[model samples]
Target chain A: MKNFYKIVAVVGLTMTLVPSLLFYFDVIEIGQMKLYMAVGTVLWFSGAIPWLGQKRTQN
Target chain B: MADKSSILKRLDSLYEFDREPVTRNKLQGIGNFLGMYAGEHVAGTEFVIGMLFVAHGVSVRDMFIGGLIGNILAIGSWAFLTAPIAVKVRLSLYWQLKKICGSMLVFIYNIVNALMFCFLAGAMVAVAATAVGIPFGIEMPALSDMLPNSVGWVVTVLGVGTVITAMAILGFDALARFAKVAAPWMFLIFVTAAIAVLPKLGVTPGAGNFWEVARESIWTGVAREGQSQFSFWHVVFFTWLANAAMHLGMSDLTILRYAKKWQYGFSSAVGMFLGHYVAWIASGILYAAANSDAPGVVAYEAIGIAGAICVVIAGWTTANPTLYRAGMALQVASGWSRWKVTLLAGAITTTAAMFPALVMKLLDFVALYGLVLIPMGAVILADFYFIPKLGLQSFYAEKKKIDFNLAAGATWFIMLALALFLNLYFKIELFFLPAPIWILSLGAYLLFSKMYQKNLKLNLT
Candidate 1:
């Protein structure tokens, strides 16, 4: 489960970073880059649900 | 079948601890602050603001210097004026106002506050529509337009508004979560899109004449055909006072109250620098790079479909929280369920969004919105500080169990009246109104409070 969380976090984070990185470095044009990144962003947050679901209360 | 009551019941089950102070255990780290501010600030409005700067004939040097200075003051205000109060009080601005102004005065204040927030969010929704309508080839609203441009525009606004409103109805945590994730990607898109367009403005990668390109092509010191010129001070005030209501008006008492420490107020710097400063500059470059009036089309020209989509989401991130705030304010004032009031608030916001005039006249609307709300913030400040000092009482209404605090109500009305008189008769511009109104609110509050308390011989501490 712990490893699953880490993998999900890493993959989700990379999805977000890669498109921006590709665009930033002039490797990719702006076309569809925002769409790609937006999907990645949603996945990034959604990936956390499993961890948050079982997380204990702060108190 | 699931009905309205069932829906309201499920929504109520979320049960955000609204009226109570947030416990230490529930305190959020700096990530939430950083993400939320960056998301909210680095938003869809930057597209319009940056384009307007070009239209208003702002020079590069003046815009850069003034924007930087103005943003710094805004950060200071969030950190110094708003954050400290928020952490100490640990209450939403609405709830805290009820304590000081009592129920009646607070009710009036909440209505004004909610409408201003809804209108402001509506402008963002309209901004999103500019992007959504790009594919359908709906004509974008011009800078001077005051009415809905087409049925296409109306349909796009409703579609966009429904999605954002649904997100807002989920409550504050949902809003924050959405922003936290969306902010990073949205911000990066803003920067990359600007860079992608530089080549079009004759500033190719090897040209190495970026400054010259920026000066001549981007922030050209010549206004569009019919627009008036903006100066350094204009840039500074507009940039600083842009969120003057959120910061100086103490609306962020609702946001910052969630912070673990007052120093987290400094976190506003992320949003100011990234969103207002860099994003504005980038969008300006895009506006100059492309001839289109629509942010979607301009971004589409530079970066592609994704760039246009960024404009849509940028509007979403900003509008979501703003509508959330409006919903909360109306819910408290009307004693209705949060989700239902949010629906009503969203309806009003969507209606406002149908008219492109809301987006076209954004500069004036923002200035006026902040102006109307500034006096109440001043009154809040006075009550927070002066009541305890002048041998009067803090939370006088709460302590005395009164339904109406005439002093607080009187201060709001009289100060607003003075402001209207100044603007209408004296012909003061919105840019010049906040400072004088602040002074006026302070003085009027002190005078009224002294007179009200003494004449009534109200319960003194």
Candidate 2:
């Protein structure tokens, strides 16, 4: 689960960033870009689940 | 319900070091101030202000030199005025004001302070929502949008507000940490997008004709239709007095109370120089490229989706601390639990986010916020240093068990009225109102206190 969280965090950040860069440089079109970003945002928020759930995490 | 309670529990546990001076051991170094001011000033509002400067028709020379002068004066206010008082007292603005003005007067001030802060943060929430809405196909509000344009806009604001409020509820360290991460990225992005889009605006980097291109196309001294033209003095005053509430008005007593030395207040230069100067210039270029007032869209045009995300995160960094401060003000004023008051303040902010006028009229709104708050700060300053020198008791309310300080109250209203007359009849802009109000209130408070105390013979101490 910890590894899963880590992977989610990394992937979510990349997902959030990659599409934007791709679209800027014209590698991605507007067709599904917004959808991809929506998913990325959700994933990033989910990756922060532990952060939201408890104050016990390492500072 | 379980998640809600957990959130509530988390919020409840977060207590600011209220009521007393922060201990020496707990005092933060200059780096904290550097990071915080940098994060805060180079923020979501930068997008709006940068765009407004362009639309208001400021020339290149006016913006470059004027912003430098204005921001330097702002730094002086923070370093010399606000921080010295903050560190010496080591108390939040609420507690300090209560000691001087008495609880009742401070209560009125708190309500006004919290509402203005909420409205200000609400605009940032709307800015963040613009980005969130982009991917959701939510129609972005125009510069002239006064009402919620669609249900999508409302939901996006709610969504953005939730994240911002939750972070604020986590308290100071968390807020600072978040700023540390976001500030660097946002700064980099601001610079990158500006440079990246310069070519599209017809700046040939090789020919070194960038200044000519900038003068002609980018920072052209021509107002948009229906927009008022602004001059160098206008830009200077706007930049200097934009944060007059925090600096000259003494609201940053809350922030500077955490500093190890008052000199750390000078760290505001980091934010002013980088965000207000460089970032504003960069964003001005971005606006020229995209020809848009919407921050989210302009950023997207410059760097794709990353730009949108920057807008969202930048807004969060700003709105989080603002809403937190508002929540704290209400809590201190109403004697409510911090969590409950924060919840209420957050709700108020989220609702205000539904209206776009808060963002569109931000230049005026910021000015008004500073002007309204400056009088109380002047009163505090006089009570702290001047009254004792004049053979009158300082913290007279605390000594006399008075719930209202008549002198402080009189000083507040008198200055406000004077400000109104100057603004309305004299055609004094909001940016120019703070200076006269600040000077007049200090002298007035001293005179009023001497008379009020002597007449009552309340100087029995």
- CAPRI level of candidate 1: incorrect
Residues B1-461 of candidate 1: C-alpha lDDT, one tens digit per residue: 24434433332333344778877876789997986687678887888888888878899887899999989988998998899999998888767877887766765676687899899899999888888888888888877678887788888899999988988887556555555555665776677778666666787655688889888988888888777778888888888889888888898998898899899999999989998899889888888988677777887776666677778877887788778868866665455777888898999999999887787667778888888888878887888887768877778778877767888888878877888898899988788788678768877888888888787674453
Native contacts recovered by candidate 2, as a share? 0.00
- What's each prediction's clash count? 1, 1
TM-score top scorer: 1
Q: What are the per-model DockQ values?
A: 0.22, 0.09
lDDT of 1 at B259: 93
lDDT of 2 by residue, B316-397 (tens): 8788878877887676545577778788889999999989878777888888998999998898788888999999988888
Q: Which ten residues in a row have the lowest lDDT in candidate 1 chain B?
A: B7-16
Error (Å) of candidate 1 at residue B75 is 1.2
Clashing pairs in 2: A20-B305
